[model samples]
Target chain A: MVPVDYYIILSAVLFTIGALGVLIRRNPLIIFMSIELMLNAANLAFVAFSRMYDSFNGQIFVFFVIAVAAAEVAVGLALIVEIFKTKKNINIDEMNSLKG
Target chain B: MTQTDFYTILPLTVLAVWACLLLLADLFIPKDRKGITAFLSALGLAVTLGLTITQVGRENLGFNNMVVVDGFSTFINIILLASSLFGVALAYGYIKRMGLERGEYYTLMLFSVTGMMLMAQAADLIIVFLALELLSIPLYVLAAFARPNLQSEEAGVKYFLLGAFSTGFVVYGTALIYGATGTTSLGGIFFAASNGTPGLLLTIGAALLLVGFGFKVAAVPFHMWTPDVYQGSPTAVTAFMSSGAKIAGFAALLRVFASAFPSISVDITAVIWVLAALTMIVGNITAISQTNIKRMLAYSSIAHAGYILMAFVPYGNKEVMPVSVAAGLFYLVSYAVTNFGAWAVVISLEKAEGKGLEISDFAGLAKKYPALAIAMTVFMLSFIGFPPTLGLVGKFYLFRAVIAGGYTGLALIGVVTSLVSAYYYLRVVINMYMREGDPTIEREQWLDFTTVTTAVATVALSFVPQWLFFMASTAALRLF
Candidate 1:
């Protein structure tokens, strides 16, 4: 069996990449995907830790996180559709109408 | 869940059910009769408030200790319900006037309040995460409630994106904490920390949690989304988010830190002290330049978060935790009442399609509506922490608690920034009385009533604050 440290490191790396994608991406679609990646990374870490600790709590938490991520994706896509309908673009940079 | 668990969460359960019922009832009701939903929502909140009041001072752990019923949660719940009532009242006029009236507006607000109430009662990290989402998802929708409007849509997307990012931080942090401590319960974490020095993973996790909460409360460095979201959302939604979501955020913050991380406070307190100072300086200084009233208040709200964070800076001190926490709670109540009142006045003066919201639009308000002008002046006075208003007493307690906790330097920063805040808060007063313009009002009876009552209460309550102060202190005592 694989060691838990390897899984945790992979999860942390994935989380960092996802966070960077969110920071660097201009498209709302990609940003949403990045957020999903981040959530899944947390899910991965939870699963890894659960196995190491022989505890079901972390696994249960992962299930809840997955469920929440699905809901978040649904809402995020709906908002993106709403924005695209009016502005005809999904770029965050172009969606700056409410400024100081 | 047992019968005891159901009873422990009676108010939250009632509110959630009522909100869903309102959503279904809206489908059958005609478009012209949306006011019924608002009235029904307010009635539900009033009943839930009563239920919550009955449970006050009765501490219980239910749902296997995932939920807590105690003085702290009850006090915060009362503030949440009262703020929602004002939110609905203010929304009634603003939504109708702007032709944005929808039953979902009230329903979503009720749902959001339920989330907030749940946050106050959350005893586990998982519950905190769930409650955060429950509170926020509705707000993201409410921010974009004025759909087809480009600004509103933009606000919704921005808030959603950044808000989701913050949630990621919270989740990852929770995972790390669980990794370090092997438990997600607050009590479990406390036991783990008290046993030995927490590992690097736990400290990093705690920092990430602070970042997540800092974003929620609009503290500086994470406040980039606040002004835009507040300015673009419907004024009523903005009002609710500013007061309700903020109080919930602080409730979760205070509870988690006080209970779960007392042993780790030395490290986190330094980070919090800097956050408090930076938020106060940036929030106040930036608010001075905003012409948009919504944006100005957004910054003011951020500055107020800094003041509340001042109380948390001394959380490590065993002797001062209760006083500091109580001061933070009292300040939240004072800010909620005065903020809702200020926003009510703004809602009354707001025109269709979000016009007439500029600070200059308030010119000559005194000449047009003497009563409104006086109310706005009182709100402004409260925001500036002037004497004879609740804001002054709240700030006095906050500063005193900070000083008692031996964070006198942070307290000095609070005082100076508050003094700096006076220039902007009073600027609204100056615009209302000293300048001249044809300012008009929407003439909504509900909104006017909210404004007048909150204003009067803001002043009247200051004279007899002992009861509220005692209640808040007792609430904080339970946590300690």
Candidate 2:
């Protein structure tokens, strides 16, 4: 019987935290995790909103978002592993060989 | 799905099935014979193009109104297929020369093209999100396809990080929109907005959606990832991303805003106006400082996005909506052709390990190869919106539409920024003809053919733009 506003507020806060992690994190691994956090936060909001609207569409979208996140993680992990092989580091700060 | 639903997405179905088949077929193909994959990819695109062509002039909704088959999607699909064909052709030569030939490249590009086609057809928010991911994930892989190349890896990481961030924004926005209106369908949202004043949640949701799409189209403020990503990725991949992503992003933007949020047009138009103006100024002004050809073109592409956004500044006006949208579509087509041609020239001049990409490398191109230089000149002129080029006609339509909507100031800003753009676009020409440095270019027949064809089309179509414009206007009419 939790209020929906509380759920929305919680979701927004979690989303902001995830976005901040993405901005502040330098490790690619952590950045990928942050992106997953952001996606999960959106999923939470989607499910909550679905409950409020009494519609199954939002829940269906969440299922798809989960699938997409898994695909993204697969690609992200592959990229991280590739970069790790060459540079011996996954820190974004040191990854800047390409510049003007 | 019903038979009618299947028919509505026939072209996309064809493309998706072919791309999947090509992905598996690529595994058995030898590396030395990867050209077969590229050739087959182009053939598939051509077949899909023919299929899409047959569906023109029809307007219907299928999949419970989750997908639309209309003039708009058809026109955009035709442009997407043509651009992808050019992408495959350009990649064929560049990849071979760089020793980066792989069947996977063509397969991934076909998948990306399929995503773009689906994006144009999507009528529901969930479909839009799916389409965006479908298009973007493959691009991330392709950007890094030049694995072991440090810069390519960097480009892939940057693009993937920012791209996922933007996708998060889109999903959250969709959630908010569904919460506010209780429906995710564009038509349903329109009915809701028409019935009553929109709530705060709806407005915020729409703004978030803009931020998401703004990143995709590389509009200013959300364009931080573009320069590095475009410059670091392989030139052919950059070319496809710039044109293909921009066309699809704008299609979705126009569809969502013009159709779904018409009632809140006044509020959103102001936001669009500011975004367009800033994108023009920043995209053009920044290009002047870039020495790398790919980086300069990246900024130029961003500035072009600003001009396209001008068409949406009038989206709220029912009277001018169709004209403005049609003008935007025509501009996309012109920009795609001119951009691919320009990149073809760049691909020819570039060497492995990213040497000879500086603007200075273009010096003396005219003396070395007159035909190539002239083709480059045509692309430069078109980018600068000079006469006898499709860029000019596209601009004329855009400005006319905006002026008709009473946004003369926005039109004026567009003109001024284009003038500013001439300084850099023509700088390449000046570097080629006016300066003197020996430039070495690879002898690639496919690249040369694409460059010449696009350059000629840029000029030839300008002289007879009526037919294309007519098609665009008809397409725009269906959105209402």
Candidate 3:
């Protein structure tokens, strides 16, 4: 049987990588993918903890998270497509029309 | 699952159901007559507002206590519904004038507001997460609703990316909390914490949750996206976003921290102090150099978030928690009113293609329209927490609460930042009154009405603030 600590450590590492990808990636699509990675990492932790505790609460939470993530993806892709139409390029950093 | 469950969340259910029906109803509405949609949305808000008002003094736990209908949620719901009503009023003329009128805009607004109502009622972390997204997704769509505008489009994408990233933190935090306690319900977590659920996981989970909410409320260190997003969105949306979104974000903060983590307040209070202080100092100082009015207001909203955050520093002190929480709610009322009033003036001055947004654009306003200039001045004063405005009374209550909690240093930072904030806020006033330039302005009935009404309320309520204070105290969170 796999131990829970190993799963946690793995999830944490994946979360960190996802966070780094979001901060470093210039492409909007890549950033979205990174965000998905983070969500999946959380899902893994939730499932592992749910199993260890023998509770269905954590698994139910994972379902909601998955649904919310799907909704986010739909809206996010639409936004990216809209931006691409106007600017003709999809570099996130190039969005400097409104600056501090 | 029971009828009690439906009764407890009657207001939220009503709004959500109305939004869905309105979404279908909007499909049939003619494109040229989007005003009907706005009116229908406002009617929905009015009905929700009435239902929320009826829920006052009636408390119950529903969905097996996954949701709460209590004094705190009731009060915040009243505020949210009223603000969305104001949001509808402001958006009515502004959208038509901006040539961005569409039934979907109002439908989306109603949907966003439903999410906010849900946020105030959320008792479980799962509901909180879902509510946050519900409120945010519509806004992500609304922010870019100024269709095909490059700046608005960019704003939408930027807001979505940052918003989603922050959401990841929230989900991860919830997972950690669930791992630490084996439950997702806030009440269950409270029981677990009190019974001594010992681990680093819970504390880290709380910290991660703060990071997520901090982004929502636009606290500094996580506030990088605020100015750009606020600047690029439509003025009416910016108006709604600043007040409505902030109220809902703070509601989530109070709900989670006060309920689930009082056992861990010792660790959380210090973190809140630093966040409050940094949010105040950074938000105020950066706002001073802003040339664009929209960007300036964005930073100003950030600074106000700091002031509201100060009331939470001593949340663990039994002697201080009630007063501080009440003060926080009072301050939210003041900020929302002033925010709407200020944005009303901004929308009035804003021209197509985002022209007339600079501070210099305010010059000659006194020359052309004295009443508008006066209303604008009142808003600026309120933002600076000056006398004869509700902002002043709100700050006084906040300072008293923090001092009573024994956090005088945070109070001092709040005072000094308010003083520093005067520099930029006063600049707009000076331009409106003293400088000389003729900036063409749009005259809309709803625009002028909202501006004048909120400005009057901002000043009048200061003199009679005890009523607001009483309401806020009555709305204070009940102890477990």
Q: How many backbone clashes does candidate 2 have?
A: 0
lDDT of each: 0.93, 0.93, 0.93
What is the two-chain DockQ of model 3?
Answer: 0.91
Off by over 4 Å in 3: none
lDDT (Cα, tens digit) per residue for candidate 2, span B177-196 = 98889899999999997898
Model 3: which docking level applies?
high
lDDT of 1 by residue, B272-385 (tens): 999999999999999999999999999999999999999899998989999999999999999999999999999988888889999999999999999999999999999999
TM-score of 1: 0.99
Range of the 10 consecutive residues with the lowest summed lDDT in candidate 2 chain B: B440-449
- In model 1 chain B, which range of ten residues has the least summed lDDT? B93-102
Question: Top model by DockQ, which number?
Answer: 3
Candidate 1 Cα lDDT to native: 0.93
Where is the poorest 10-residue window by lDDT in model 3 chain B?
B471-480
Of the two candidates 1 and 2, the one with more favorable DockQ, higher being better, is 1
